[model samples]
Target: MQFQILRDEEGTKADFLDLLENFKPALKEIRTATNQESINEFIVKQVPYTLSAGELESIWK
Candidate 1:
């Protein structure tokens, strides 16, 4: 969920973005971002990840 905000830049508070940029000056706003399933695909390519059975179960809790 944290990574979703990073990828999409949607419904994010402006102050939070500024605070994040303050610590790491390299952080820049993405002008054109997508809140799509594509972000998941991009992440899987970089590092293969699998949700454990417990993790899956927790989602509906």
Candidate 2:
């Protein structure tokens, strides 16, 4: 799925968190189909955030 990051800073955090929450299933599906390394690479390529280790772990769970 194609995703876009909002340009405004005002709602960035909430927007990102919402996307993270909503995209959990898709993320899990990707993980199931690919290795963690590949999924991480794909996330970095597809999403806007520079997700930290903790954040990545939280979502994956």
Candidate 3:
């Protein structure tokens, strides 16, 4: 149910939109878990942590 579309720089915008429109019905058929359902499915425990300003800056770099 995943698609990776490559867009050409020279392609017309209308054509790209039309191609996407073709997938509308199929896209509607795709199902996704709700936030609570997704959290319930994860087996690992998540811990929250605070990052120091210096650590955050280095992470961006």
Query: What are the lDDT scores of the predictions, listed in order?
Result: 0.37, 0.64, 0.35
Question: Per-residue CA lDDT of candidate 3, range 1-61, in tens?
Answer: 1122323244343443445466555544552445323422321122122334443223222
Least well predicted 10-residue stretch by lDDT in candidate 2: 1-10
For 1-61, candidate 2 gives per-residue lDDT tens digits of 3354454443454576576787788777767535667766766676556777776677787
Model 3 pairs whose backbones collide? none
Error of 3 at 32 (Å): 3.5
Ranking by lDDT: 2, 1, 3
> TM-scores of the models, in the given order?
0.24, 0.53, 0.33
Return the TM-score for candidate 2, rounded to 2 decimals. 0.53
Consecutive 10-residue window with the lowest summed lDDT within model 1: 23-32
Q: How accurate is candidate 1 locally (lDDT)?
A: 0.37
Better model by lDDT: candidate 1 vs candidate 3? 1
By TM-score, who's the top model here?
2
Put down candidate 1 lDDT per residue, 1-61, tens digits, no spaces.
5445544554334433343344342322321235223433443443223534443223222
RMSD of 2: 3.4
Better of 1 and 3 by TM-score: 3
